[model samples]
Target chain A: MLKNIQEWVMVFLIIGAIILIGNWVGYDILPTAAIPGILTLIAICLLGLIIHRLLPFKLPSIAYIGILGFVLTIPGVPGSTYIVQWTNEVTLLAITTPILAYAGISIGGSWADFAKLGWKTIVVGMCVLIGTFMGSAIIAEIVLRFQGII
Target chain B: MAQQLQRLWKDWRLHTLVLAIVLLTEMIGTHEVSIGPGLILLLPMLYAVIIGIALFFTPLVNEKQTKHAEQLVFLSVTLLIAKFGVQAGPALPKLIAAGPALLLQEFGNLGTIFLALPVAILLGLKRETIGMTHSIGREANIALISDKYGFASPEGRGVMAMYIFGTVFGAIFMGLISGFLSSVTPMHPLSFAMATGIGSGSMAAAGLGPLVAAFPDMSEEIIAFSGASNLASTVTGLYMSIFIALPLTEKMYGWFRGKKDKNPTKIPSRNQRRCYKLC
Candidate 1:
């Protein structure tokens, strides 16, 4: 478990550094300025992972990670001001850049696996992808209209 | 042992490539072009995916390194989850206010098999359609199908095909759709935002990039609502897949194929009713 945490810290720290650089180049948040926010984000992720490990029942740590971040930064929570302010300095798009890049790299050799899926699978996959988005969007639009929220 | 493992961190190839990709893409910035009523909002994240994929073909990348790159994705997205979660926090009240729409959105999620299953059948995909059409075929969907059917099952291949497609094209495709939808649809930014939370990390970020860009004023709400909806999707998706999505897809698969699903109850014993009251 300690080893696992150690590896995670390494990955998160690496990602945090990339996020800082991207923020600097794209949004001009400055690597120095964003450090505290980056640290806060990392801390929350670690905390969530720890909680997930300690839990008697299994739960997705992603949920814990998200919940901890949300609970800690909610309007009236202690330290909420600092947490919110610092994290806000980190650009959302800047964060996604490295994540997706890694995603792209991870599958470079695996294109063959995709090709193996063939045209039938490709068409079906597209149908699933578009269907999910449109199905949800259509439903949400209806609810929004009926609720007059639109 | 620790020392050797630590040396893996020195493998700067992974970090350097990702760093370069992020820096270059962010510099390119966001560009929105109107092709008729459809707006194509090109985002840096989109570029990052493309560049990363392109980088793979070059001598700089190899299969082993790229495989490890895949492992990092699950870890990396937590930071994104935290970021989105923070956005959802302050806007908790607004999310609750949109509660009914949020609730019904899960039904829309279950509705995907309805669209996908038919097409899979038309395309001559057999039992594999069950896994592919189920739940947009994210990692969890892969697990759910593999657990029940084993990874070698046709259903498993169905899920995996969609999963691979999602990994490669989910972000780009969703980005285009979201961007175009934002400009053309009369639905508010919030509706589009809710759709952005299509139950995955890259897709959520990529989907919302355009919505947030298109409706800058509603960016915060867009982020917040989607974050909450994503959480809902992640949580409910498992239960929905187990109870609703799988059964519905299996039932629909039989109906669509006309000759398949000889038993109707494949493995889960739906006739056992898996219920006391609902049946």
Candidate 2:
């Protein structure tokens, strides 16, 4: 019954797509918005199907990571000189992002595996981060020098 | 509780030390001004990549530990992006106006899941595992409620609702408090309130964006002052939600459970642990 419903939905969708395409063609709006939206939708569908096929089914952790990155970016708000404000933004990002990321990972994986990683993980993690930052600084300096922007 | 607190402290301590050292270096050092923003964004990404390299080198680095570090770095990158976008590009209103289209464009990603589920069902996937793997009903419920009840159901929606709620209440309360305090002090009530409210997340952004946009002529220090005040509120909201909300919700559940008549038939037969496990 559900399969039939699914087929019907797909058919309806195809019909709708044809109508939309026909209208766009009739209106000579082919190269403008319709093409991009349709193309983007097709790409997303293909990617989704490919991902479903390749991976053992799991939620996308990357999207949540992107969201975390989004939240962290909040503090970099321009033209603020308050030390407290700066720290607060950094602090919120520091604390909340990890919790959220962990929650996401746990949701995507086994809860049992997540619970085992203790405070030691965070310490080692920071050490790795320091190294990362140092390497980044060098690369950024080189890039800036090359671009003559620095 | 103690263990969790200790973990938070350890992580935060390291984060604080790094930020302090790096920020101080940037301020005190005679670094060229032109490459500042690029450098800022590059730092967190570099940190993530380097950490990835370190994980590869150290065979002893467990999977979870690597994930924990990655999460932190991810957060840092997120913070940088949001800040940079606001500073260099169009502000919040413009960004939000773009949000709905982005969401709509991504609807295929959502719809494809529904497609996979019924297929999996046809394949005679294990009932228990299938139940654990999909959350269409839960998602539908959340979407429905968010549209209807809006931000009232705390856990029903994710951070979006909380952001909206916090912004609304934070602005009203902070405005009043700042007004009262400013009467006796030199501080601008709006700025003070804004600074106090910023850390809580939504309110700080909404409040600060509008205030800054409104008073473009205001000194950076004044804006900073508002942001600074909001810092504490944001932190308090973050920490309190974890420590307070969880326990309070648990207690509320217990109280409701205790008050319930002993009607065994009324209890849900569906396994909640199994249900939530999928999400």
**TM-score of each candidate?**
0.91, 0.25
Q: Where does model 2 exceed 4 Å of error?
A: A1-150, B1-81, B84-100, B103-109, B128-279
lDDT (10s digit) by residue, model 1, range B16-68? 98998988898999998898988899988888888888889999888766866
Cα lDDT, model 2, residue B139: 27
Candidate 2 has a DockQ of: 0.02
Best by TM-score: 1
Off by over 4 Å in 1: B1-8, B259-279
Location of the lowest summed lDDT over 10 successive residues in candidate 2 chain A: A127-136
lDDT of 1 by residue, A1-150 (tens): 788679778878998999999999988888999999999998998898889999976679888988888888788988888988888888787888888898888767667787776887777777777778877888888998898887
Candidate closest to the true structure, highest lDDT = 1
lDDT by residue for model 2 (B151-258), tens: 333334322322222222332332222223333334332323233332323223323432332234642333333333332232233333334433443343333344
